[model samples]
Target: MSADLLLSKLEGVRRTGPGRWVARCSAHPDKNPSLNVREVEDGRVLVKCFAECDVESILSAVGLGWDAIMPPRAIDHHVKRERRPFNAHDVLVALETELTIASLAMLDIGKGKMPSDAERERLLLASRRIRSAIELAVDND
Candidate 1:
């Protein structure tokens, strides 16, 4: 569902800013508007209740399921494209690329060849990136 349709279904919706609106919270007895509703650039509706109401409860009160807040393309099969999930193989490929570049640079260094300033900077960046990737992989596990 579009943000306009959702806002229309809500009670006491008034524009607070461009693409932003305030509405009465349906999850509880609210005299003043407590719900902040906005449409992001990607066409997804964002709803937040200032009363600290849970999203599920707020959506239930307004008779909308989770799908209502998702991007339209995500709901339409014709528009939705399959996305690959990031896995160990993807991480390994990135690490391999970094390692290959570092290894070649090291080989040149071993042959008594001095690296240019740009090459040295690239080597440092590759090292830092590999360390970061390792940390990410460990944290993921």
Candidate 2:
């Protein structure tokens, strides 16, 4: 609920500060403005009676309910989540290791001989790791 709507229902409302005001307590008879009303940055209305009146009682008197002034259930404003599971340093280290393996295999092939069975397995693992790193880097962005 907006502060203006709440203030309209109140009597003898006077500005106390930015986004804040004082009004006569609707729950009880008041000769002075004892009720405090405020609108916070998150768009929630706040009400308090200095005569020690409960919030529920003050809201009830003004035809307002708990639901009208409740805070938002979920606020996603400026929330930054961890988009990548692995940090850049870790990913770089992994890619470097895979590159070393691939380089060794390439060197063997450049020597006019194919990599042995075990070297072939290592090359396959390196290929898979490089492909996986590429996917993670692209998808997270």
Give Cα-based local distance difference scores for all models. Answer: 0.83, 0.83
Clashing pairs in 1: none
Worst 10 residues of 2 by lDDT: 72-81
The C-alpha stretches of model 2 lying farther than 4 A from their native spots are 71-141
lDDT of 2 at 44: 80
Error of 2 at 2 (Å): 2.1
| TM-score computed on alpha carbons, candidate 2 | 0.50
Model 2 has a clash total of 0
Error of 1 at 23 (Å): 0.4
Score every model by TM-score.
Answer: 0.51, 0.50
TM-score for predicted model 1 compared with the true structure? 0.51
lDDT of 2 at 115: 91
Model 1 stretches astray by more than 4 angstroms = 72-141
Model 1: lowest-lDDT 10 consecutive positions: 77-86
Predicted structure with the largest lDDT when compared to the true one:
2
